[model samples]
Target: MRTLHRREAAAALLALPALALGRPAAAQNSRPVRVVVPAAPGGAIDVIGRIYATRLSEKTGSPWVTENRSGANNTVGAAEVARSAPDGKTLLINADIQLMAKRVMRAVPYDPITDFTPVARLATAPLVLVGNPAGTPNGDLGALVAAMKAAPDKFAFANSALGSMGHLSTESFKRRAGLDTLVVSYRGTAPALTDVLAGQTALMVAPLGSALPHLRADRLRAFAVFSPNRSAQAPEIPTTAEAGMPDLQFTLWYGLWGPKGMPAEVVNALNAAVREVGAEPAIRARLTEQGADPVDEDAAGFARFIGTEAERNGRVAQEAGIEPE
Candidate 1:
């Protein structure tokens, strides 16, 4: 009995606040609430999730910790959350990729909308079109488009994932520019950027935060930013509107969510916590450093926005002939 008790205690220590180890918010316990980031650690969403979790722990007097569950373009983590108890103990912080699972892949496990409750929109980052300096002519978008149109068979774009903001936005841009080129989907951004830097691919629409350092280091060239105005980090770059691609409009946003059927009070409390964290100057500064604009929005508002975005993206994918894989 003594040896069995020791083994059980060791197992409990190892599980120290990960997965769905904690009880529901209604039935509180000493275990910490797990804030799941559906992406690997040290990535954009993981960084933001950690920041929010740290602040939420202090703000709500509840121990909150971040847990990573990355795979299948967020399907693995999202499905796990959908199956978890609709308690406040397990939460999700994911990017706009949350809505694109159905449109991009054929074997998604859950409905992105109905399986989860949208809590609040945390931040948004502008997407920029970037190309290798040596790969394109004279670092100009017009020149690149002309050359791509002239020889449509040679050039292709690289996207980090199938349903990522980078992928869909680039496809939309290709359609708008009237180019019939291939878009190679890599497993992640680092590998895709590697190919772009090596001229294996011609261009990619990446989040400003991910591309800014490379652009600053002279490793890549900026063709356009998919926004109304220039990014303050790279003010020298022109907007998509300025580049004469005004039809391409998209922003990479991060949001908070939980399993469906969570109590309204729990959802509202989490939403309020996000807003309070968003309003902090320190938090805003951190997000700004990451090239994101923090946003303040309610749950219902975010839900409506998700519906609109999903519909638009689905239409765009269909028009671009992006079939599920």
Candidate 2:
């Protein structure tokens, strides 16, 4: 009995150092994090970033600051984040434009996959096809397709920018319908939608959130929405699949990312905080109001999703023969 007791005590003594070492590491807390918004102020990305920053700060007991660094189609801000220290103190909040930028531009400074690590996916907003109510045959998707096909080169589609989500969706629609519509690129969605309203342009593909007011006012007619499922806010509008085009699966999803080499513990901490924020009722409500659906995804899943998006955009750009602006 004496020998057995000694052995047990010896084993307990050997475990003390590990327990002591583990406690300090586990107790370590992160400092305030800075979230970089890769767009101008008053944009959807900025709004989402601010909301996420506020919630993450509250949940982690660490301040989160949103910094807008807009330029170069979000490449300037993304590059800044990629060059920042990988200590979890700096994060990037952006949308699908990042992937399309890489696909269209040949002079990107950093690699999209290698320079940063995905932290989490926050939300997704679907795109909708809208046309001026005062215009030609445009009551439904089939009518619009028929009009575009009949005119071919005369029909024009407006887009937010040269390589934006709106541009890609319009291009995909043209390809799917085997039509030859002229693509008119504007500086932003507001200008493009303005042109469509003023009868300057015939049609456009814009975010459902941005088009909701116009749709409700009857200024624009929504023919189809680009999403895997129908939107709850606008269930009357049919999805692209129901419109007979299942290949048009696209959404403007927002996510968080950090520079490469971020520590595993820090990544885990940020993921937990983001997931909590996404699951909150207030956050979900805000997202719904913005025409965005909250999506809870971890680092690994988001990273994989990014990879797939990059590849898919690349293929689409190639097929469209899109040139950099």
What are the lDDT figures for the candidates, one per model? 0.79, 0.77
Tens-place lDDT per residue, model 2, 1-325, is: 0122444433322322222233323222434567898776756677777888887665544567789887766788889999887766779998877677666677889887788888888888989998888775756788789887777764678877666777788898889988888888765566678889898888899878778888899898999999988899899999889989998877888888888876655566667667877888999998787788788888889889989988887787778878775
| TM per prediction | 0.86, 0.82
lDDT per residue as tens, model 1, 31-130: 5778888776666777777888887676554578788887888778888888876656778888988988988889988999998989889999998888
Alpha-carbon deviation at 48 in model 1, angstroms: 2.4
| Candidate 1 stretches greater than 4 Å from native | 1-29, 198-200
The clash numbers for all candidates, in the given order, read 0, 0
Evaluated at residue 72, the lDDT of candidate 1 is: 81
- List per-candidate RMSD values in Å: 7.1, 9.1
